[model samples]
Target: MATADAALRDTFTLQGVTAVQPRRPDGGFDWDWRGPRNDPEWAWFFNRHLVFTDLLAAYQQTGDVRYRDRILVTLDDWIAQHPAPSGITFSAAWRPLEAARRVMESWIPIYAALRDDPAAFPPERRARFVASIRDHALHLRNHHAFSGNHLITEMLALTRLGLTFSDLPDAAGWRSYALDRLARAYEDQVYPDGAHKELSSHYQRVVALNYQELLDLLRASGQEEAVREWEPRVHRLWDYFAAIMKPDGTNPLNNDSDTESVAALLRQYAPHIRIPEQTVRLPWAGQVIFRSRAAAAADAAGVRGSGFGVQGSANAAAANNAKPRTRNPKPAAATPPPLLYAFFDTGPRGTDHDHADFLHVSLSVGASDFLVDNGRYTYTPGAFRDYFAGPSGHNVLLLDGLGPDQGPRAVTAAADAAGVQGSGFRVQGSDSRFPSPAGNPKPETLNPEPAASAAPAVEIAWGDTTFASASRPAFAANPRAADWRRLVAHVPGRAWIVVDRVITFSPATLTTLWHWSPECTVEPVPGQPDSLIVSRSSATLHVRHAASQPVPADRQQITARSRPSPQGWYSPRFNMLEPASCTQLDQAIRAPLVNVWLFSPAALPGASIRISADHRIVVQLDPATSLTLDPEAPGKSAVTGTMR
Candidate 1:
């Protein structure tokens, strides 16, 4: 390894070094490994550390005085703003001490590089840096105990520093402790299926960043054997990361994913490990490790394999369901949509991380989002600035219009997990429900899972009374609408919707809320049966079962176009149930009431119904109906009357 003093001797050679910045859409330069922009809170350390680390690497690689000078200028800026009582420095710029620890680690290399260049870093700057480092380490070793990622980073820095200041036993102890913590953290935080608990893209980047440091530390310390030992585990993590990526190169962006450059970083590692250029489509453990290992082998052999770690190897593992240590074989599709489902139980009442979308589920069909989770709006203004992050952002009830309170204190540990089908996932929480119409405040739980193994479908089980039934409604507008007009003469035509769940309703009158928002005008197409055209948008409603023949215009009466107030669009919770007679009401008391919403268009005089188990029909009567759904009901029973 090149010593910092050796590189410092050749500072003049730094003149011609060319840096290839991360690319941008507009062709500008960005240094972000994942992308140009990132969350200010998290990216604070990431960017600062990146610039500092690059400078440190440059100085170390080329003995560049200019690089050390640039780093000192930035370090001084931080020192001036955060001078402590001991003339050290600290920063409140980020939350969760884990973030600060990263900033701490970035300085170790900078210090080593800077200490070698006397002219570039003065005594005062070095003193300040040391003071800050020791203070932070002291606090971390005492106060910050829950930091998983921070422990690894801080331990590495201490280990590096310990080599120089041989008297520090704490540094070595910290390193030992970090290794144990890492194994446990990896076991718990990283699922057996390799899914991350946070599911945030930013966190994925952080994981990569953490691993890079560990790999760098191992490599620099002449511990390549450790890297070889860890190669499989790291490969599994990378494989997990690759599996969650969408075909379009974007992650699902669920949870707290703000960074967009993760795809680029993954590409960078692909060549090193020999992952193919195409998107991965398999669901297996340690895929990234396998691909990387395969890459290493192929690069060494200078040839590709027919069945060894190739891209799109789905059936590879299908033939082997036996336990581990069994010899494994290799295998191999699509413009498949990004279909994901998430459920929030515990009623969005936990910490700021918690969302008030208990019993809420969202679907993304094709590229468009349906029943969406209103993506996060802002992070600085607490959590209330974005109404969508509140209960209103979901398809479920807003609960007497009361959203979760956004206060100063942090809310944590509000989610619970249950495994389904090995790869199946369920996260539940306490206090997950809101007040029902009957004034009963029940705790809601959101239970969501993939509808099938390796399919583009998800089943969300919302254990809340409010989500009794849900149906996706589709409508076609006749004569469409005039260009540039917000209001259009919409000739309502009927389409079919497939309801996945049986309507949970009491023996009373059942009402359905036909809610539409995006603020488009809804015009009632008079005389057309099974039709209503929204002026600004097009809609398609699918029926799960039961076909309807198009009723002629002469047969219908009211052209009821409802314009709901305050929010510009319509959210008409239309009551569609007939009052059951007293005699029959008792019989229907406990059984679920399912409703099929079918609209007919005149052009196709006969309405053709196509049903998949894909539609939603949320009933409104009994809040407890969901708990009673027969576990033995066939998937088809979720929807009846197939007429496609």
Candidate 2:
């Protein structure tokens, strides 16, 4: 049997594009590997030289002369074409930092593997490589990004390069400056509860991996004090992953995130840190996860892998059972099943790369994701980019057909207005200029009023009933017009309840949207205009709404448009998008508006809801249990009563 490292070496593949495949050294080389590809951005990323790591690994495992020769030839060609402090590699500000970082990371292992082979890494060629690393590191030291992940990546690369070349005259200064910046990044970037302030799961993983790599280098170099100081923060970062990771090992596609899994991170680092098995709520991070007890029990029994570990046995069993069988399967147990997994987000108005998806929720059952966040496809400025990063891509309320404000600046403006409005109780008139209902408002024209009440606040409680609540200004333009409060509750073995309440001072329009996977189908319940059935595979969800007046049939519709519309779209990967089912319900709001949705594996029986004159809500989920909510006095509102 092949060793684990050997197996990994055998399965090496470069970035999915085959256009830049390196050729053998025939006394001549092509430094410009992109050839005639028109995509400059793709070529830029490809030419970063990260893929050389694969060649290094292959040569180390198999002792292949071809792989070793190719590495030297490519390095020689690159150095000859782009000298120190010049050429496209060093001239572009972004490329130099990234190229310096990737080159250091990819070349270190190869240099280590071939250090003894004088023929492969002759002293002159080795000096050239060292000079290139010095130039790249000096360039990064001179130029710095403003903040966020870019700064983090650049500093991390410098730290690694400094440690690797510690014998150099200025290496100590480089290490000190890089470590100081890293410490500041740790304080500013990672939230108190381990969430990356940028609020992107994809970038969270990226940042975590960068930290882990730095720590590993520290440990290898006997820097115990540095490792000790940084270990806990790295563990906190992984804990966030353990909390929000879905049943399928992926995470919620929060804010500029892709459909990437945390399994690889866990697989690499699980042995070093402690992994949590129970549910957790990261209050500071504005995230809450409701884990299934049944799943936990199975995981404890070793029937299912824990903490994002690979399930090799389960995969083998599945592969063995691929063929159809005539035998009858055993009946399922009669006990109540576990509640589906649920993730809630009510974080701060995110940073630059973050999306405006406040109070968004994602749910999954077994291995299938039901309600999902429209993932970020690309950073390119266009219709798709705007939609994925806006409020319409999430499961939230769009008041008067308008999404939330864009970023921290907009959020601060709204909060300041709310402070003034609350002190004076002023209401803006209809003549007040607001954004167009089309959902695209010019930056200069966006002056959303503050809510008459207050800014959004989130509360979480766990036990028999796991739930989280967020109360916030629903509309940026007409913040004083209405206040929105959302509650998400997970009742194990029963159902998941999503309650949305909007209290308005004047007439307004409320559009509640739910985005599901492309595989799901939705339809209105027969003879029940207030309810809809959303089904995907074996799971189903029943959504209901309570309004002051009857809803017209035209206002409730399901769409799966491929265009860049707000109603229906899904992006599974970067640079790719497809149509997905989006169920929308539009209702006219005069007084307090309450809408409830119940999700279950089995069909849910009909329930009754009553709203008192004082805006209190009574919902009978089943014959045995009832829930009462009074928005006016939230502390005293949540009561469980028996249905008579």
Candidate 3:
């Protein structure tokens, strides 16, 4: 019987089809075996040849001749089946680019493993391998993606291949073109604040890994000048990941982000970068992290209690829970005041990979995620895709069942009229909301063109143990008929207060959506019309809302049911979806809409939220700590005593 590793190396399994037969001796493989050429799953499976690298690793580890033979056979089969400019590989621009990257990344290590052993990889085989790599580079150089990470990956692959095979006849031209394109992509796709234009933390990690490999290749080739030129930008990219990572070493699924990808990148690159041990704020990226000092102290004490050894309770706990929390309780907390990590997205509606989620926040206590962004399940365009990328999947204000401006495309006419082009125009429409006139216009009167939504003007502040950010009237779907402002403040180890204030001139329904991790259970607080108790093991999140208008008990709903209309589903990885606890607060807009969320480790000592007629919010987290927030002046919150 074949070992598990041997089986994996010998065959490619995808979409539940294990041990798929390889190509015929004549070198013809089934490109579209399951169904139509437009099958989304087939497209996804075809592009993800990541297993090729796995096979190479297995061969290196076990010195397995079977794995090496499999690699050679597969490479030869693919090259023969996908001849230059004629096969499925070159039919679509994206597929070819993806194949090029996968091939380049897979071939390098395999070549290294077999370099010294001429019998394993003879001169003829090496020549064939070089020819195949050259073809990939040439194909990528000619076909570029429309934008986003696709183009970036293509350029990175080209550059790596050119540098690796610098002795080839066309290597210099490929190297030069790839280098120029990569530089431009860094400037265009990376924000000045170090955030990727894609806005998805997962994609940010992808871009980072691509650049890290590029730098490694350049440095190996003695290209110090090139390495220096790109190092700072790459470091900034790492900084964004460092700032957004949670206590569990994963990032919030703010857009189409896969939790697994985020965790993998953190594991791969975190040690090489200079990540601060405490709180961090990236104002330009509109992100902030508040690390609990108490949590750190407790972790330190837990290690000491475990004999002060290298393998302490902290390490054991981390090791036990290394896989992303699927449907289990988090490892036991080290002590009181568990690590609190929260991410607030107040920046632009990033590139195509980003969802229309503005002012959406994700919260976690220790290793367990509580409130989370609905993750990207698949890129296939359908109802699921729309819901995942729309406001329904996020924790934000949904007015009259409509999300932020998610029309087919942004209205560039207004920017063109203003004589602005490129980024100046793009920045003008970052808010993802359609502009409204000053008075209430009938729904039919609203137009998608000439007046688009303006980007939210944001203000952020970071203190020793507190972080605060506010967005002003960012959503105006109808011309001035409604105004929305989101204020988020976090006091590490204590609580997080999010206040959503909406003022409307017309009759509208306001719904606040909160999506929690699938492991959490949510229920309405007994006898409380506007509160919910979300419990996950020992940790609990106390949610309380106070509004000037009447809020009925029937307005609150907690469901883990999946529906076609994006209500209660969480996708931690691509192509997988699970039911999650989704809490919605529905209220009629008569006066200002104010909803408050207070998240903590356990039931609070004194949990009461009062909204005065004058629009001032008073929140009491405990006997000694209380906050008075003036909605009109979010930055001027008065604190009675120190909770820390």
Candidate 4:
């Protein structure tokens, strides 16, 4: 109501920019009221007309006719100013993505609300409104996003136009064309394991929402056969989102992602949703979810047959529905919080939303995301643009500051990145997810290699606690690109062991980075040991480097919000920045190097280590979590651990 009242007075704030968009002397809206020219996203976001939805919602809530009047007047005036196939103009309202959102976010909902309100939408005006919707649909049909999440949403909106207004002449054609495209897009955009191709948790959510909306529309439009064909795969999309989610209810900021929460939405349909495993792995996406829910508490309480792997308890339906809980509560000594929720991205760069953070891991203890990624700061190129999208903005390896083979198509400041992947920012790409099946047109032309061409980045055996990934792409373009492999293991109810081995016969500078959440307080251990106590709220994680594979004292330093460099910074969301702890270890190496980072439940005790001359690593964190990593360990057996 406040927002609608504000809109009535011609004041609108969006994307953190507030402006009083007062009506003109003639009481017509000025469609070109650009607020805050400092950020490039302002104009683009403003043109989407999502703000107009607020007015319609207000009218429905209060039954205020003036709120209703504002929606109609704004819609009519905007339509009058910009004809279908609108000419190139400063408004940027005709951009197909803006058009798509306007259709889904603005036109469809508002039209449904007021379509029968003849006092507001009389016959003549109603015909005009519907015609404008057709124009938007036609524009979208001809000119759509080249590819990526935006394309999926646009197609869904187009399909919506066809179904909602089936009475229209070309509505059937619109639905038919969009349905075919959407089906093909599903095959291309999603991996075999159900992770979205962009590999961004945020974009994955976006694509999944639109995809689900498409399913809902299909069922509502009396297309039960089509719904049957799509439901399973569509559920897989939801499955990935549910898996990679952090303990705090948000997924990691792996690629171009926001700290988005899907817990509440998932809870509403808890009974129908799948309960995530204690450890979830999407092999195709090279993602591993190393987590411990109430299972640890169950073990301590001698609670048997809690059905941890089967059905989810009622509480499980909420909070990403990640963990299954106990149906009957046994009196516990204390309220046992969830433990060690981590998202390890041991995968290739996504086809879009590519952050150069291969081998990146985000860790959350209980409710706090103690370790994190520098999120997508903004789509605009300046200040933190390259930093947020590049290797420095991530937790990964850098050789002489050279990152993953970004390829020639890497987004540059001079390049207009729209047609590339919707994000004009530099993102990691050049990934070949799952191979296309026979008789399928290769997914996106922007991706050069056939999906089958690239080697598997990682291998996993669900029965085993340890798995390894070889990030060959990370070193493919480097002078010393011979070796890049990492092993990640969950130590039951104990610890997570991450081991990285890089071979560099030639002398070069190797830098390894770990980006921590801004809320975390990282204090170095009070000794010569290379360790830190990472604590946030009541959760504390002990982090240490193996003594055998140690970092030199003089070579390590911590950075926090350095303006001269994009290091030590984190983006909670787009256009938001905060200082974060980024630990960088630089070592000048002329031989093969092995680095082991151990994160345990309690403060890390000194661990025994043995590195043979051939680079075989034998490290023991505790009795239950000893690991032997051979230099020639195949992708599947990257690390042989004691648990197996």
Candidate 5:
């Protein structure tokens, strides 16, 4: 056996240790050094584990004796605060214990380097660290938190324990169990299309970190057989992350989101495991496209030199020397496909685990999201808080402020009546319908039906191209809500259409205008009872009812105060005519009005009518307006454009 001097030969000094906060120069880092907890205790614990892991790594890499001594003290402190016998340490949602176990086992290398040096340390201190490892491991197994947060950590603990203590009879059995659990977790946790359930880019990075750690350990132990088997699975996880990244470099916060430390992990591992940019479409997990398959393959193949994959591989090798080198290199992944997707919500009130939107849908063209569902704002308030569960946050109606009748104002019903499932996207089957206003004289009246279904069943078909068809229901939400009645606020609702054309089939009642303005501002044109307009740079001109027409005067009252909008403000402006010429607009491509330019106060002149070379008549809406041709009026050439 080597003497203490020889055992310490491999130790390296830590440099950044002195600059870290909440840590003594002697090496102890505070677990709760950042701030007070605002999240659940379990989540807080998870955060704490990160701090602990970093501190431990600093100690191990620096080989600073002070760092080791500090780790011992910190471990003692943690053990005292979280006693294993109490059952509370592993209870509830806590995950730090799992991390604690893994870190303890990793210390085996340090201990083995000193095991023969009886004079270097007191017997009691050495025994404490060793005993702590076993205790934490047992606690993790008891809590079942091991596999839930990526089974990699627990697997490391088991493998390290087995390697360090060969004499223990249970070590062999535990190793087998750990290995099997890992395989099962991988199969179960990854979605059918390889998306992570947590869906957060940060969480994927975390999973990748754990995977690299496990793979390194396996290789070091001469378990190349197992490492080879896991190569593709590991690559797929990275691919999943790359696929979900948005064009803006942000990953949509679908599940748990922790932006902190994500960039660091990406920088650390991205180079080694360059995930391929292959398109992976999972309609169920809300990932319409994934373009990181290539990067993943590079990482799995352990390609080195030149690319991001090489950097990660070098880091992995440097971080742990136990891994055996492999020659397998992943081939480049295929080019990603142009992914278009739409999300539909059939669930009621969206308070249930699976719901919050009854008729909300978001559409994505490639990486750009066009129509979007405003994602979660706050997590507390039990997921149904007003901001996350309100009509304003979604593409649905507020229904006179009497939205879907969930149980309490604070609590919403989780109703998922129907939904669509496909390879690349999912849409909710909605029974949400509204009557065609053609026959109803009072189409703008606010009527409530408790037993009414607002969603409609729609059919989608994809071949060389794609098309979606849905029979119009008796009712639909008004795009301009407040216009139907005066004093009553109008909430805008939207629906998605994929075909080249959208035909209303029936002569649909209610005004339809394609609106385009970055800052959407819809207001009644002053004095014009039936006409209203919305503008971003310009204005959308709308006329709800003509003065000559007998309209519901009770519903048409002007507001006393004006609301501020992007272009300007709207005050109590009335029309010059007693009743404006509120012409019923049909087959008309209307554009919202725009101030010609910064210098030109001239309003948008109506679009120039043109006949195409092919003899098709074309009516262009104002540039500010993203108008939809009257789907009810078929065979008419109508087009609208909105500025990006």
Candidate 6:
């Protein structure tokens, strides 16, 4: 309520920017006043009118007439100061996304609260509010969002407005157009496995929230038939979010992403979607989030093989005539070990929030992030933007592009610094070409994924320790480009191994990065230059890199919050930045180079790995348990591990 009171006084802080709006001679607030930073984001928030919603909620809770009157005054001031947009423009006050958000998330709710109060919300003000809503709808009708999550967002607002104002002359047209576009946009943006195509966990949450709201609206208004059509998709979106959750119950900061509340989203739709919670592999999305199962308890609980882990075919039949789970309950442990969670990305680079993070992997021990991607720095395209989106921000092999010293490159320019731009996850938006409406076929990507969001053509091998592999074709325009392949296995609570191989047709340089959480302290293991011990909280992780051959010592470096050349940074929020530690290895590849990274609680004193004549990697975890990783063709899923 204090925040609401401050906002009412024209003192506002939004998105980390704080400023007091100047009062006019008539004591009215300046609606167009941007904060000191003059950030477009701040303006977008101010115009969203979310503060009004907060004031309304406060009034409802405390029965404060001041809060209610604040809404009337500020809203009247806003409508008077800002007129309808002349055309589709990105002025601070009239961006399409914010406009949509203003009505759907803020204004409509405010209107409902004040509509019955004739003195508080007189007929003239009500008419103006409705008129502004019509203008917002007209502007959103022509909006196209780079074929990104914004498309669905704008359409969602239009749909909501049409449904709420059914008596308006244009309401019917608004509903029909917005609904058709939303259905098509949903198809374009969501994968069959339920992952949002932009591939950002933050955006996935945004898209899911929008859909679930639409679904709830449909259900509440007796739109039963429409409800039936949309329920499964909403369920699938939430399912993917559930699969990718860390032990802390939040999604990984992959691509251009930020942290979002996982439980709040689930609370709305989880019960309606009932799918067994376990390790999941979404092949169509080209990703796998592995949840290590307790071996003794899992097997005893009738755990069947999913091809992602230990194959159970040798001991069982395909029939489900096994003992009931209630009868064969899992045994309890006095103290359970912390489960290891891993998020692997080998899919498309996404259309809008594209990141050069192919074959990237994020690891977490319990709730602690060990190997992390420095989400996105900012979308404004600066040094931080390049570093956060390029090879330096993720745990992957960098091929002949951005090296440890290449400073200040944009994502597009980084393509030259690093040769593989848009190599993996062949994005359908070729060079920012979004797919046109249903009948317009000319704008489709050169090689769009099999049309319609269906199960992937080539699926992930499901198991206890899931396996996924991807191959990035040589940079088409670079003669020195190399064909690259990455095969990874998450041994659940055990360990994780990544096999990276590059076939260089010509001389090329490479660098490998292993990003660690800022809380982590990394140092080379005594007398072992090829290994490092990373300590975070009370836990420790040992990371070792062994190439097909040896790498020179001079090529390895530890860059921590350094300047100019290499970047050592992380972003916990959209506009926030913090220094972090990073491990980088440089190399010069002539013929071929294959590198292996083994991450575990600790490396066995005598643990050894062998590379075969056929390029298969075999690691002896101990005398009894061994893992053999065989690389497969790109876009094909196959089981390659012997253990779960």
Please list the C-alpha lDDT of all candidates, in the order they appear: 0.34, 0.60, 0.62, 0.64, 0.35, 0.65
State the displacement of the C-alpha of residue 258, model 3, in Å, after optimal TM-score superposition: 1.5
Instruction: Flag the better candidate by lDDT, 1 or 4.
Output: 4
User: How accurate locally is residue 253 in candidate 2, as Cα lDDT from 0 to 100?
Assistant: 89
Instruction: Rank candidates by TM-score, best first.
Output: 4, 6, 3, 2, 1, 5
Residue 632 error, candidate 2, Å: 3.1
Instruction: List where candidate 5 sits over 4 angstroms from the true fold.
Output: 1-69, 80-83, 86-121, 150-168, 260-280, 284-286, 289-644
* Residue 340 CA displacement from its true place in model 2, Å: 2.4
| Global CA lDDT computed for model 4 | 0.64
lDDT per residue, candidate 5, 137-205, as tens digits?
A: 555455444444535566656656765665666667667777787778766555433344444444556
Q: Which model, 1 or 3, shows the larger lDDT?
A: 3
Best by TM-score: 4
Q: Could you tell me the C-alpha RMSD of candidate 5 in Å?
A: 17.7
Clash count in backbone of candidate 5: 65
How far residue 140's Cα lies from its native spot in candidate 1, in Å, is 2.6
lDDT of 2 by residue, 550-600 (tens): 543244455555464655788877666778877777777666666767665
Model 1 quality (TM-score): 0.49
TM-scores for all candidates: the values are 0.49, 0.75, 0.78, 0.80, 0.47, 0.79
Model 3 lDDT tens row, 322-355: 5665677666554433456677765556676878
lDDT comparing candidate 6 with the true structure: 0.65
> How many clashes show up per model?
57, 0, 4, 1, 65, 11
> At residue 357, what lDDT does model 4 achieve?
71
* TM-score, structure 6 vs. true: 0.79
The better candidate by TM-score, 1 or 6, is 6
**List of clashing residue pairs for candidate 2:** none
Candidate 1 per-residue lDDT over residues 5-81, each given as its tens digit: 33233221111122223434653223233222233433333334445665677666777567677667646655554
User: Where does the lowest 10-residue lDDT sum fall in candidate 6?
Assistant: 427-436
Residue-level error in angstroms, candidate 3, position 518? 1.2
